[model samples]
Target: MASTVCGWCGDRTHMTMVTDLYQLPEGLWPTKGYSATPDRDLPVWMAAFRCPNENCQRLSIGWAPLHRAKMGPTKDLFLREQLNWEPTQIRRPAFPDVPKEIADTASEAHACLSIGAARGAVALARAVVEATAKAKGITMHGIAPKIAAMREQDIISPLTEQTSHQIRKDGNSIAHGDIGEELMSLDDAAAILEFMDALLDEVFQRPAKLTRLSERGTQQAPGGSADGATPVQGGADFSTPH
Candidate 1:
């Protein structure tokens, strides 16, 4: 099996264990499978895996089915269920070095996603965007205005502003139950959360990385002078050995 991200450990490590495999009886489905054959011919696999992270070596189980295309040269295996046994396990999005409040809200959003609460997840994801904007001092009255302010301040690009507006609109529809707006689906909620992840990277993670690099360069620079005096500009001997 190929390496996959462990839901338990939250790591992309090589860890997969096939516990069982079986083929369903023939004529189980009235429709054709991906191979245009009967669905009963498909192979169902049950697997167990351990997280590779030393701190989180928890076990997880998954079920998947193999599929083959009829007209194309495509064969694929898709996971139907992948879950950790413990309900209280940590499940978080992969945005590192985010502020505590934003991270906490995003974690809740992810939990809601896991439980199929699409509306709740989208609401929390919208909260994450609001918190991020507030952290950056864009405390406008509403999410749309805040996003607009962020774009005005060059905190986000115009494209990102449009996307944020769309996310906020969806979240508002879920909150207010607008008749004309479509209900939030699981995929919709997940997409909003994914956008938040990328936004955090752009606003927080990348800036912090550049700051660290600058500080490191300053710290590693050679001393000013032999007597601890400030070196004059263009006065240092470039040919001298350290």
Candidate 2:
């Protein structure tokens, strides 16, 4: 069994090995299973993996290949490489609290990041911010205006507004081709993604959490007051201890 992230459920769990490491057929090996050819010293293989999550016991697959190196006549080589394994080994994060439209755009941005399209991710990060603003009923024409409006409405804090403006500028540069994907570093992509998550959390998740808290506070038990106290016939110091 191997551990990998389930792409479907997005869980970090074990995957039961569904098959032994099977060597690729010689007939199909020529095309390298419709992918790039393997190195001369490496051979292709396939394996099946099934998720252990009962609700998500779906099957996934991957390709495994062994790399051989010859050091001496008596030397034996042993190393294996697997591509596109189950669990995707990449995060496809979910912004459940964000509005559906904004969440979808953010997901695409994350997909680009996971695939190493750093500039595309950054460009789309800007789009996500715009979508979030629109979801909040902000009708400004640009990210800067929208951010300023959000600050005015108390939708975002002053510090966040300042940082968001900077992100908007970076996103604009990337979107207009001023910064190319090859020029964007992985670190930059990661940092921008973190900011996106934080912004979404503040705008959506926090508000939703507060609403839930308010609803709970207003809820009343059957035959009891909203404050959770039940009336007693005698009413002699019936209050519960704090």
The top-ranked prediction according to lDDT is 2
TM-score of 1: 0.54
* Shift in Å, residue 29, candidate 1: 24
How many clashes would you count in candidate 1?
A: 0
C-alpha lDDT of all candidate models, in order: 0.63, 0.67
Q: Cα-based RMSD of the predictions, in order?
A: 10.9, 9.2
Model 1 spans with C-alpha error above 4 angstroms: 1-90, 94-96, 179-183, 223-242
For model 1, how does the per-residue alpha-carbon lDDT over 93-181 read when each residue is reduced to its tens digit?
A: 55567888898888888877665566788888788888889999888798888888888899987777877887788788777767364
TM-score, every prediction: 0.54, 0.56
**Pairs of colliding residues, candidate 2:** 5-87, 6-87
